[model samples]
Target: MTDLIAELDPTQWYRDGRGPRYKQLHRHIRGLVSSGDLAAEDQLPSEREIADRAQISRVTVRKAIAELVADGLIEQRHGAGSFVRASSNRFEQSLSSLVSFTENLQARGITSASRVLLKGLFRPTPTEAMVLGLSPHHQVARINRLRSGDGVPMALEYSSLPEDVLPRPDKIDLSLYELLRARGTAPTRAIQRVIAVNATAPVADLLDLAEGAAVLQIERTAYLASGRPIEFTSGIYRSDIYDFVSELRLD
Candidate 1:
């Protein structure tokens, strides 16, 4: 008698697989993990028990579990059983509206913090020229940071602005917009572009995502009241965590 039970879903891959039982089982479990039906830290059924239930050899179950572990989807402790890996959750702000990260998190009842990644004077590269409408000879201030809310990393932001705009990039605090306003450089409006992308190696490392995970990329060119570009920057956000919310009014 088969001791193991499966939620029989006809649409699941294993139902018509052309492989051995072990291979079929492996694919089935992975599908569940990817779909989030089996969540992180949720214990997988014991190998011995599952083998007995599925009427398969224990070696088959072990082979399947080994592959999942290698992919970082499951982990096995010395004594404890295997468990699914949990990915991070996310929060998102809009590219259409003007707001600070601190303010946005506060509105959501979550605390926000910043860890500065890069702060220095940078001469504009060719890419910056196209984005900011600046000459290659122009110098800008660069700031890279990991912005988090309620202690979870949300987005990786890299911004560049004319050096004359900030005066001292190192002295700036959490709210860049607030500082700009204090210095009489209010960014009245901005033009932004949005794209969906897969996180690169460095981004994945900082955002704690599995390599090549989906993310949203937003690039903005903020303008001063005089219609002069004040800042040009981009942000990468986790796809699972953030869903940009926008409201449209009919004319």
Candidate 2:
């Protein structure tokens, strides 16, 4: 681990430059882990050791380690220091594009499948009613699916659509977006918000994670070309098996 840290290019550590030193270290260490230099379950050097070698303060090392822990890249033990996390079913997703789970997995050459947990018309929650623009008297199709990639459970999706837009729940299966396209109500754009949440017991069981594990929660409202909202969904993805990435460019 010490040798691997030393192997990182010195030019990349701009401790006195624009960004914070800990961020620089975080990026460098993350690269090492992603590149296989630091294999899964490998113990990282102590904070003091890293600080002494890198000529930085222990504070910086601690901050960088905290960020990596939150990202699910490293797990810190009470007395054993930090170890690289092992995830055989990890996936990275781009936030720049609006695509269904099936489409995303297809692009990665992974098989996507869904186990329908619930599918039927149901009364909308207050939040769902507002997001889907449905009347209080109307019902919506509430569909819960356990999404899998390469036969491993990856996420639990709960989606709602105004009954007037979808009507028939029996015909919907696999890809909801595909079915929407056939109905001429496919979403061309969407507004989404993502946040980190602790997994509940039931959600943990469905996603094969331990209770209280970290999960990424995404709330999305999808709209058609006419600007009419077509779908509202809440998805809980296992952080250990998924990553959301976005690229930015300066003009």
Residue-level lDDT tens digits of model 1 in 47-152: 8777766666789789978867765677888798887776533455675689978788888898888999999888888877766677878788899999887676
| Root-mean-square deviation per candidate | 9.7, 12.5
Deviation (Å) of 237 in candidate 2: 0.4
Give the runs in model 1 whose Cα sits over 4 Å from its true position: 1-92
Distance from true position, residue 137, model 1, in Å? 2.6
- lDDT of every model, 2 decimals: 0.74, 0.80
Query: What local lDDT score does residue 250 receive in model 2, on the 0 to 100 scale?
Result: 100
Question: Using Cα atoms with residue i matched to residue i, what is each candidate's TM-score against the true structure?
Answer: 0.66, 0.66
Which has the greatest lDDT? 2
Residues forming the 10-long window of minimal summed lDDT in candidate 1 = 1-10
Candidate 2, poorest ten consecutive residues by summed lDDT: 9-18
